[model samples]
Target: MKKRRGLSFSQRRAMSGFLFCLPFILGFLLMFLVPMLQSIQYAFSSMQLGLDGIMLRFVGLKNFRTALFADPEYVRTIAESVRDMVLQVPVILVFSLFVSLLLNQKFRGRALARAIFFLPVIVVSGIILEILSTDYLSASIMSGQETIGAFRGVGSYEILVAMGMPQKLIDIMIPVVYDIFNLVWSSGVQILMFLAGLQTVPDSMYECARLEGATAWEAFWKITFPLISPMLLMNVVYSVADYFTTSMNPVIRMINQQTSNMKFEYAAGLSWMYLAVVLVLLGAVYWFMNKRIVYVGE
Candidate 1:
């Protein structure tokens, strides 16, 4: 092989990889960066639909002031959205891990099972979720017309509900009662990431643990959990974002309505503010979880 001047084989390979990604890099800057800057500009302005219905004028920082201090529903809506994020993140993480463990099991039909778990990541979109939203699986329970709900009655809680479980126990489960639904609908990516992480764990590590008289549960707690912690962190962030931006999400609907009503500047400000809050929360999660993660290669 002829040695290239200045650039080694690996360096040349890196350059080729950068060249391959050039189109995506350019598109991201053009499509996302320019629009994002424009949005930030608009967020500070006081643009509104005029009486002629096709004009706009600037009234700087008024939109932000209205959203922060004057608007009736803006604060409440944002608070509710953030509350949902906090609740949903942990619920999604635990349930996704549970489902992933099942999918990772060595079973005859495991591939099919994994596909079923991943259906949501593939098929979930605005249209499909809109169709499902009309069904309102939680409506009965929410309205107190039924003792329990549809999917909750059937899936993970089936055994307890059928066995005449205590009402208190059921009540306690209410906070995360529909978590299985969230899990089933969100497990696609997390399961795949977990499977990837599981592959990275060498079987020899388990063998060594076994030789040291470590039980299966001990091996999982000491070896498997730490090894996969980074993937766990990634899935947590993805699930939180996915929940907030989902088509079926109420906050997104509210934002859509604001846009349709031509409240462009206000909507833009709200979106930017909301995005900042989410970024801060995600940054906090990363900071707190980063140290706990064990880098197996190191």
Candidate 2:
């Protein structure tokens, strides 16, 4: 009999990755797929909980129509959520990258600093974050009359107005700046991801750049940025998903409200519509960023 050839290194690595992902793949199919299909079906039907169990009647596009046209606040809330996402994702990504870079440097208590930064991911649940926002954090940030007066008196708002910026734009920027802490807190996982990516960069590349008399800024653009471009894309996608699904998201809160009110079919329609919008935006981002990502092998 002819001897069988052993698997190559690349093939073995591919198999290992597939094995690692098997559990998640199985869980997604078993747990998420059925409910997702049911929800889609419900979106096209009227659902009622009955003594017999549940009743679903074909309602065609009525639920979609109601969510889109009948509900006054649904579309507006979605629009607001999208606008917040646009403002928040970039800030989160930048903050995460900055923190990751800082943490990657050798320093006293580096591990402790990383743990401190990542503590929010472990301890700050949705309810806890909400409580903190309502009780002490947001109150302190927004209630400082002196700080508010100083900001206003500094001609910051006036400068923007004189620069012909719209009042709506100014309104969005103020709240976003005030909520920067919350945005930074949301970057814990992203910071960790960037740290991992940063560790993957070969030190020799930086040493070579240094030998060439490159400044830290030049080395960063020439070596670090391109090397971490993949991580940037990953963080962008994660941030988008996290922002949309977080409890503070107005769209998600609206959906939860509908579910609480037993408007199951309407909520399903709304969720499906929101999911489509997210997918479209995600696709656009992926398309734009995918072209710019530089692979080390490439």
- lDDT score for residue 137 of model 2: 37
lDDT of 1 by residue, 1-298 (tens): 9977798899999999999999999999879898888778778776655687735567777887887899888778878878877876787677777777777779899989888888877766577755655555643332223335654554545767788998688767754545455556666788889888887888999999999999999999999999999898888778877777765566677777888987777788888877877788888878888878888768
- Residue 58, candidate 1: Cα error in Å is 3.1
lDDT of 2 by residue, 170-253 (tens): 888866776665766788999999999999999999999989999999998989999999999999999998889876688988
Global CA lDDT computed for model 1: 0.76
- 287 Cα displacement, candidate 1 (Å): 1.0
lDDT of 2: 0.86
Instruction: Report, for all candidates in order, the number of backbone clashes.
Output: 1, 0
lDDT for each of the candidates?
A: 0.76, 0.86
Pairs of residues at least 3 apart in sequence or in different chains that clash in candidate 1:
46-59
